[model samples]
Target: MPPASLPPLPLSTAAGYQARHLLVLPGDVLVDEVETLAVSRFAGARWDVVPAGVEPATVAPRTAAPGEPGVLRTSRHTTLTGPFAPGPGLPPGSAMVFDVVTPRERGEAAFPGSGDRDGLGRAFPAGLPEKEERRAVDWLVEAARRLGGSIAVDVPSSGAPGIVLTPDPGVAVDMTLYSDVWLEPDAAQAVLGQVDGRIRLAMDGVDWQGPPAGIADKPLYRGEQMDPAVRKQIHAAADDVDIAALTSGEPLDGYGLLLDLGVDGMIAVEIGDEPDLPFLLRGLPWAAGGAVSYRVRWEPDDLAASQDEFPPMEYTVARKRSAGIVAALAKALHGAVGGEIADEAGFLVEPDDL
Candidate 1:
């Protein structure tokens, strides 16, 4: 049979243009295999495929899936199968797959009822849990090794707490903050309050209605409506406070502090509307040399339109920015940490040398 064409959907659209890697959720291999072959044959693009399964630690040892032929190997990719369980509450069946592609590849349409309904207003289709997603991510990382491609995982900032997998010394792993979860004023304040005594606060681009003391010297780095004066105030506040640490919502301009800024800890905030923020946060501390943690909060919304719009406009904007930051951070940090591994990958060698 001939390979299938890219699906008609947002993921497919993004994958077709922007994706450097393709991740296929478990139980969806049929779709992925068909699409991958089609893309390779028709589009003249080669995609690396990785199978998904539960880790041995999590699931009891079991045979590979039926007709899969245990651990198929090829020059382009490797495929493995096992009794891998999906995260909690995932439908009875779930698996993971990886398809490494370039920006030129297109994506297929969302599975029927598998995505949020258009105009539904913040309504999302039911999905699997975190562990399930993590399994997919882990598979991608492993796949990177066989395919000689860099691996990056998108996670949330608040949920940034997990055991780090030390990849091959030279191999670079990217940890990005997923920014779909909104931090409401109260929630943000509470997080700030938690670190009030432990660390001083400051702001870079945001404004305060009153004295800096009102914000407890906590820096609101790179936020909405932030200005130069606000940044100055944050700097001044940093000097006054003990300056236990520094964090930014995103990498700053003229902010060489990240490399030389001496502090007990440093955190890069990943804000987004996606639920993946926590995963990213958990994975970052390992990528960067530091002891780090994340806090998540969201604003309450009361919209009487469709069930889809409840997340509020402010939350949506924040989420978009958050996702962008996470994507940027993943690329940057991956280069910083995994440049050597990427070099060994060979495909990225020219880019690195340049």
Candidate 2:
């Protein structure tokens, strides 16, 4: 079946604050199937429609009939949106909300812990216990496959922005890598060489350089002075102490490198093994167990034009380039040290997976 399309829904400030996921079904599905799906997953669970003005928390959930729309309360905090009309198109579809919040507060009081002050804390948040989030992701992936569709995340700020579960590989640039053994600076440099080679094979005559000489003299708009200085610092420190600080987290020590991809952007590579893997990359058993890993990221140049919201052509192109680059790097790393590559959505990346 062709891929289902999800029109960007208006972002609800209240519900949208937490990372939100939606399941987009490509074709029409009978309400019976939806019920069956819920039962299969939740085991004899019942769904009910909270009357027009009544709150979900206030009412007891009576069994919903086959064609009736309702809410499937999986737990006290999580609820999956019930069935809605599947619209028309060659790849016609409708989205079911997978919310990780209480129905009564509608996610207002969900996962409130945060030690991050002044934007310095772990990149991996303490929000929603990993166990709970994992349960949610597992169900979402299962639901998408059950419906012959894909999983999508509407939150752009998510670590895995523009993530969709599709067979035909598409670029999702933001990626993380977990390795069983520590890969040192020398090994990392070798991996960088491999990545550079792959990119050159794909794009002819692309420039490869570090922060240029006299970068300070160059205008910011020229994009000549582009350098991931912070990443470079992390890399130097990693060489000394071999631990890297996570986003918003304290800098201990770690190994990393930054390669300027010119127009595509700068790639930041950081290595650390102390912390558990980011939630987005823990789908696999071994990865979930945790190991030394590299967080490969693409930082777009500031001058790049903002992608148009409607068409998203520019954005698509940028992601393709960046994602392709990181994919190349992942393949190279896999070849070098024998590790797994995972995208932002935490799925193990196959060669065909972008």
Candidate 3:
């Protein structure tokens, strides 16, 4: 959907602070259907019905008041023409739109307390609390079961980038903060073994290879196996603790690795960290002090032209395979190293949630 048609959700109206999510359906859905879904999904919760295009602020503060029952205004749009047309990567067709508005102070059920913190007590500044975002995403996913479409986080005014949630199952995976702590080579290898075993068992046709072709010959960016500059910076920033001696040998046997899951995807596991001190981990409250900071990325294999034309089912299969491997790798690392993980979309990913 175009930004122009996507009205920015008001941060604060007379109704107090609020948040909204957009659900785009493949076909027109009746307002009654939307109402039923809302009622069923949020049973016993108060709901205030409003006409289409009604600003949330104009509504009374009954739902917005502290400790009062939360209010949700569901607005339906049947005519998805012009700027409201469905964009690429979304289901193509005439679309139906629904805007679901909720109060911002929904507490831990919707968001985390203060700055985003994990079970390990790591806290970091996040624009939209990852916990709340995950809760909203759960609703969108539920909506998709009945509505058959896509969802987007409508935050055009916040200066943050727009986030779209879809089941496109695209051929890419970028998991950040996969591990908050680094393990010794032996422990790292054990984690790798667990991840490798899990991936192989979960995905039927996965093939593992040592590094990508020519990576060994290339000038290493983050380390020489280790970088003197990075070592000095780490030592200085980390109260003179020798993180290098702590990490010792390469993680997962080698810094470079690959997973080929047939023609659908080719995922590269790049293991390393920032050359210099990362701003997020520089000072106090630096939770990921021992982080190895690896990244898992994927792309279509050499037969890109052929794979690009594959059907939706193929794409979804590829996505599932790649996503599963990334999840397994992350879960294993978290279990071994003790830290949090984030998904491609930058939301905190709990290992148990996998």
Candidate 4:
């Protein structure tokens, strides 16, 4: 290494204070948890016990530079290494990090280790899946097996289903299946009243695209699925369509099965004209209320596509545990892709997000 003075851990690493040394423990299998709440908050939404000076709020996620080990991003500033590749001093197969810092204090320090540091102490490394995460994995596998097999029906994972929503209103969901399957504009509108009060599935906006011809026809609003060429002609004519009046029509039935069954996460899909395609599934957002959402992209990277490509299907899940939901999604996607989908960074950080 470079210096002997570095502590085993650090909070604001740039400041280099071991203020409760915050090392990414270089291992897995640490232990920790508690309290009860709604299934919505069942396992994800919780607080971390950090030192007074070590504000979790300010901390930012730090990962080894590209070509280095993968990052385990639990939250914004809280990402650390995953169990598979522990750092120095950490034993192989160590599920949790053993230790890091040596000193910390509540109030101001005479020596003065102060300031926001813009983030919290470096995140601690992860160990094994918590009880909940493990359960999520199991539940997803079972659900996938059932759905993939001849049982020939959708299975809702029982518990408070963690739902994911999109910012755009144009997306419609096929309730019969668990994942995000896109619907025609009419179909998307039909489910609104039914899912009233249900948590919206929040996404980071990269995974969406304009719906296909039939699905996107009769634009929901101006520019919604409107072709650029056609828009120019309309603009030349100075015409305005009453989008609201145009869209007001009778709602379709049976698309509410996803909400009706109450699943953890739903993936709505829109098929492209191309028969089979390769794509990327990026960003996993485990929301504040405890919903896990991710993006699925069909385009491959120019210089760095993976030999093992991403799977080509969209899906949803409602289940006993988000751990199961997250894990199952990962497993299914991972298995579907057959290996790995290379990211710009080359490290598969998104996969470990589960």
Model number with the top lDDT: 2
Over 4 Å off in model 4, which ranges? 1-21, 26-323, 333-354
lDDT of 1 at 45: 26
Q: Write the per-residue lDDT of candidate 4 for residues 1-354, one digit (tens) a residue.
A: 111122222212222222211122212212221011111122232233322122232233542333232232232332222112222332233222212221222332222232211111111112222243323222222222221210101111222112211111111111111122334434332333233333233223464233344532355486687686675666534323444434568453222111222333433322112211121222222111222122222222221211212212222112223233323333343433233322211213234533
lDDT of each: 0.30, 0.50, 0.46, 0.25
Q: What is the TM-score of each candidate against the true structure?
A: 0.21, 0.45, 0.38, 0.22
Measured with C-alpha atoms, the lDDT of residue 157 in candidate 4 is: 23
Model 1 scores worst on lDDT over the 10 consecutive residues at: 253-262
In candidate 1, what are the lDDT values of residues 275-332, reduced to their tens digit?
2222223235443432211222121132221123133565445444433333343343
Per-residue CA lDDT of candidate 3, range 1-354, in tens?
222233323332222354555566665554334444444333232235333433333333433232122235432211111113343334465354444444432323313332211111121123333444445445555555445466655433333225555544243355755344555544555666666642221113454333356443444564456555665555456533445445567444236456666766766656565433333233325443544565666665533332332345666666677677776776766676664565553344557866
Q: What is candidate 2's lDDT per residue for 313-332, written digit by digit as tens?
A: 56557667777778777777
**Which pairs, if any, clash in model 3?**
110-132, 182-290
When 2 and 4 are scored with TM-score, the better candidate is: 2
lDDT of 1 at 326: 31
Candidate 3 accuracy as TM-score: 0.38
